[model samples]
Target chain A: MSVNARTMSDDELFYGHKACPGCGGALVVRQALKVLGKDAVAALPAGCMSATGFNFPQLAFANNAMITPFAATASVLSGIEAGLRAQGIKPDGCTVVGFAGDGGTADIGLQALSGAIDRNDDVLYFCYDNEAYMNTGIQRSSETPFGASTTTTPAGPSHPGCVTGKKDLFAMVAAQGIPYAATASIGYPNDLLKKVEKARDIRGTRFIHVMAPCPVGWGFPSSDTIALGKGIVDCGLWYLAEYEDGRFTLNRDPGRFASVADHLRSQSRYRALTDADIVTIEAHRDQVWQRLRQRCSCESS
Target chain B: MLEVIWHARGGQGAFTAARVLGAAASADPDTFALAFPTFGPERRGAPMRAYTKIAARPIGDRSASRRAAIVVYLDDTLFADGWEDELAEGGVVLLNSKVAHPDARVVTVDGSGLAADILGRAIPNTVFLGAIAALCDAVTLENVEEGIRATMPAKLHERNIAVVRAAYDLVAGRARADALPCCSEAAPIEGASGEKEREASSVVSAEPPARIIPQLQELTVAPERFARSTCFQGGHLVSKNAGWRSLRPLVDQQACTGCFNCYLLCPDGTIYKQPGAGSSSTVAIDYDFCKGCGICAKACPAHCIAMVEEGGGRDEALHIRQ
Candidate 1:
């Protein structure tokens, strides 16, 4: 695939807001806001972004920003767009975006998000996946990857990190047969921005799953957030892909994928994995990405 | 018996000040003071009230103060909301102000200025207690200092002691100045541009503020008591979120792979991805929520993203991502 297109355009997000040092979720929200621009109204659930960005006393959005319930992010976003439509405001004039962390998207917000997708609601749903319940002190979420340690899934002699792998969130969303569904990473803003622009333009349940590396939750050096995001793709643990019009496209093909161990080296969360475990994880990664590639190819053909 | 009411935004130490006042009053075997806060959100700048009751004997009545012997305004802006009606007819008002109110009984002190200069931030609660100690003969300065010292950390005792002394001297000086007929009206407050800077700096200056104060709207007349709050917004905050940051993340396209990793990895979702040519598109960062965690710089396998010291120097670690 081609790389490093052009510089991103300026938008409404400004400085002087709060996020932790090296927050990947903040980057995802910022870029999404810019792509959506002044016309966008975002409904965010209780998550890291809500705690940091939509803080008390002030909010970061220049546009309307609503704080919805933990499980109602997608539902509230759908309601906001529906309310606007009921008031005779064209959907095109105002973009409704639902933002939630992995904990919200994969766990608590599943039913609401599923319902929104089922209804084919005209809204852009962005899930900035940090892989755990970061806002509530690094607890394990449904999206927490296997061989990673969280507060709830603490690595110990008997238990080695999370026993279960991450929920296949994109597949779940795409299975809904939405108009647009894609996977993105904060490490590559241009690609993520392109996906967002494409999703919002396509209309009807656009779900973009973004990989936001959390320094605090992921147990990595704050500065290594972007690198870890790329590491997951390079290791075949994660793949960048898009699902549109029932067709699949592999966004980033790692000709020679880095070993899963290489990806794990940077994250302390994965420190519990033994050499044998890494081998098992690598095999799992290959099997998953290989199937994903086959599905993309079959759909494209 | 003495009834004192404190008017403050939350987090400015009004509750703590009232607690300390009560604690100090309790120290005297002859008096007892009951201090508690009203039902208010824990937001930083939302209008909050705390009451302190000191009596020669233990009082049984536990109602809110209808008439106050002394009203302490932790912020001058609260004056705009009107505190004159909360006081007893002969009550005196102690305020954190550079200029005096229209009334002769109104006493002013630059608590924020003193707090910033002394305590290194704006916390006028302790300063107000010191002023009350000076105005009221009931509590000794030693007792007030003891209360402040006991309530605060040992390290803060030195600065808080300095704050109390400074406030004591300030009100004493102002009292002497105002006693003169020529000085009937207090000299006009100076350089009032920073009045917003007076309280605890939580969250102030909302971007594209729709209303100066949030509109308190009722969705239904007969909603549940808990459901009465229709908005998710917290109380007013004077603290700026920006001051929490130390570094910022920036991107370099030359070494970029357009993999969309950083766009997805941002914890705050501040990265914007715009589709251009499918392979190589454009992306932007929203600094408002960036928080400079540099997850992008770390996540970029292409080494295209870098972290720079926020409002500081060029970080040698920031190489050209290309």
Candidate 2:
């Protein structure tokens, strides 16, 4: 049975500007803009999204777009909402989105974001988590998973790649008691679009964390970006899950997970990983699954 | 057709100079010019660079500025750090310096002092523009003046024109030198065979660290004036209401070579230097205390003094307005 495609909107929320070929963030943004339509006002930070979305006077977005500093997306969106309310010029059914990178969201903007969500601000916070800071020449961020090599955290004789585990932002946002929080991926465009549509209707903070692959930062061919994104899920390294009102749900499950080596072999970021490192990563994945299962049970109980 | 590399600190008018030069070149159809900055997050008081390419034919390589026919040092102190090496052999070097150069052909002007005299503040970019026009004869003083007017505000246009005239006259009457013989092309340095073999072996044998340690150093913090709890003072947070309040503009008169790098890199257009100011034509930052992003220090060629924390101040949080 053929599934019906969602009715696409003519309004370009993100104007067509140049990004690196096969940029996962760019593709995710395109899908997001498609879902958001004309009534949306995007507050982008100093990341790939901002650079690619606006090119001086000729912006890719058809609606109002504001490029903000790296870690101020939430504050900007809050101010925008307050301004509209103060002017008695309510946006015509507008969806206010604060888009940022993982570094901006999970690390730097976490406080402001937490405050905004706690205040129950009417904004959708989308974290396009490419793991590291790709714009600043591939620096390691808190969201960067263990074993991933960034420029600052190179696998040299003195040090390995990123030492820290990925920040559990979904749980952190859920802890704030915000209305909705979900993890999406570029590999699943339809699912991502649906989540965005759902979040648009919600009044309070709705968080969507998407795993976007960076070809330049991740040291992978542009053609392999999508494949690597999908491979992460297939290897059970990254999972698509959601938390809504204290309830946890795993959106997609891999019955039998592929080897961690399969995922690592595809990206250059993990080129330095040895056999022992692969085993350790596999064990970490198993532990994550256990935690996820426990959370799922707790939610039901 | 001449290519020029303008070196200045962030907040200097290096980019502005490049843009103005490009604009002047655009006025002449025979000359094709393109100006752009090297992409990075270089902030005020940091070393920043800009390139302007003017060619009789359409420029092929649209990348970083590798070869420059003319090297304009808005701040002369930048020259102490091998800034002259960027200049093509026999290319003109217009510097904002007090110490005269007798060895190589150099045009010296106190642009910062001239700008301060004209505009009541030290901004030497217009002066450098005039010097560039006079030295290269690539664009006329009229074109440079027009470009300045087009680039600057209406209120400051007249003063900028005055500064430009001062610089033009300073360099125009100087004796022109014949182009120096080009240097012999240096042979490519070959990699050591043993070193190359060792590098290959290391790559293959390298193992990921058993335990990765995350560096948890405090990242660069913004200045106190900009540091606010919420970016919600005015109805619109995007407005530059409190943006320029607590800037601590620093000018190292002893070190400033006055190349105008800072003036060009400033996104807010808030930097200016004066040639022949006080003791020297030193580069001066307008916003005394910058947001402390360090783009200027990184861009400064002179290894001059940088903006540091004045004292204990609350780190300002940047609030973005949607």
Candidate 3:
């Protein structure tokens, strides 16, 4: 019913941008901006969002944005934050946001993002995880889950999909003892917006890992980009959590977890996932969620 | 060899058009045809050319065709860009043009519009196969239908077949009408028999104007650059992103609720919020930037944005965007 119809205000984005229909990163950015507000600058690396979201002569950003190298989003935003200081503008006054895709964050930009987080750079790094390198036509990335087919990791007679599991990017960020780290999804915009606002107010390297959908790369109808993401969260495949002040917070409680198999069936990429593969993925997700819950309980102890 | 050259933007089904025609020609007992693209920068909306060769005997030319018996233009803008150099003497031109090219032996069909009308989208790939079949004696309409039947899904075959037939009959009917030179509407004015007579007399002069060939610009390429992913490193966006789409998204401000649903899911960031779009900031679609994926239409919560089948200038026969 009317999700986000109340707080709709003047967007910091223009029309006539060239993104494909049902792009999850587009949704994530639009939602994130509602919290980040107008006094924020975006540092985007080459991704699906960077490719179709902005064009030459006229770009899509209504805020001050810079297109950085895929591995250099954090580094570029670091420079921008420092540059803002030279002009006597408080770097903290304006949020320096680094927007990158899963591959860019987990693989290529990992070094830069890690260095920024390690040094506690004044930036809100957002890795809108579409799970693969979607802009270059659905190639496999570190963030892509196991048993999901991609152009590089083709599912065939011997292969079901990707053989390896997805990288634990949130754990990696939280392990650095960063000021703030969290996971969110477009399915829950209220939670997503609140987290973005919290990160906007907090200083140091704040990270928001978003499980955004990819219609073309993920082989789903554009209309299902949002709807399917809800299933992802509902099935406990993607956990909504935050880590700060040495405390773990689970945003969504799985009252009853849906079978991950039931969720994967809708995705064409994971269509080849066998019953056994589904069992393995569900078991693994359960183990991860159990460990995360244990870490969350440490707050009470 | 009956060489056909197709001038279109990238991802506009140029290769598909070539393949369909080639498959249709190959249906014959003794005929063989080959289709391939003359690749440029491989991105959306780049000016691209695809060649099809149909021959009664074995053919060997692998190089791009310098001369053609027929030049079929998939995009209307390429005709304005000048493609006559590829056309050999007595060559016929077939294109999706609103106005028929009378000066040259040409057959014009509103294929884009026909495809949109019949297929619910403006891709016109299979429709041209019928137009080609009607214009060329080599492939029969049955052969083209067979090609369409083979290439498309069972659900789509009937619609595409009908649209292709409509194009074939229209062009074939128009050719016959012009040959007879019957004036549908005649006005007696001074010694002029009718507007038809004026049309016949006003045919381009015997010594037509000389063709203007644009000078070739020198292009330099680095072989090593192809190995890396330049897109992640702020690589150059050389090609026009807009030209790649056959269907374009146009925002209906009156019907929009400023929900930003289209602006959210657009992968290309082609949709932006323009000020004064009504009570709220409604979205704007940049034709030069949109890739015609129709995701915006699917995501429109207000159901106002229409993914109109654009290109080929056949809006009159286009179906309402669903």
What is the per-residue lDDT of model 1 for residues A1-301, given as tens digits with 9 covering 90 to 100?
2123233434435223456777778777777766666678888899877786555334456567778999999999889999998998754657899889998999999999999999999999999999999888999989898889998989976778898998998899888887899998876667787888787677789899999888888888777777777788777777788998988888888778877777887788887778888888888888897789788853222
Model 3 local distance difference test score: 0.73
lDDT of each: 0.73, 0.67, 0.73
Instruction: Report the C-alpha lDDT of model 2 over A183-247, residue by residue, as the tens digit.
Output: 98866655677788888777888999998888778887654555677788888888888888778
Taking every candidate in turn, the Cα RMSD to the unseen true structure, in Å, is 18.5, 26.4, 24.1
DockQ of each: 0.15, 0.01, 0.09
Regions of candidate 1 where Cα sits further than 4 Å from its true position: A1-7, A90-92, A298-301, B1-322
- Scanning candidate 3 chain B in windows of ten residues, the lowest lDDT window is B179-188
Ranking by DockQ: 1, 3, 2
Alpha carbon lDDT at B12, candidate 1: 93
lDDT of 2 by residue, B2-32 (tens): 6778877776688888998888876765455
Per-residue CA lDDT of candidate 1, range B1-322, in tens? 5778888998898888898888777787655568988855558778898999876544545778977878888988887655667767666888898776677778788888888898899888889877877666556678888887778788888888888888877776656332322111111221121233323123543353532222222332222221313343332223344445576666665445677667655554556665545567645776644666665665667776767677643344344332
lDDT of 3 by residue, B227-278 (tens): 2112211222334456667667766666778777666555554566766543
Sort by TM-score, best first: 1, 3, 2
Each model's TM-score?
0.55, 0.48, 0.53
Estimate the TM-score for candidate 2: 0.48
| Every prediction: chain A TM-score | 0.94, 0.93, 0.94
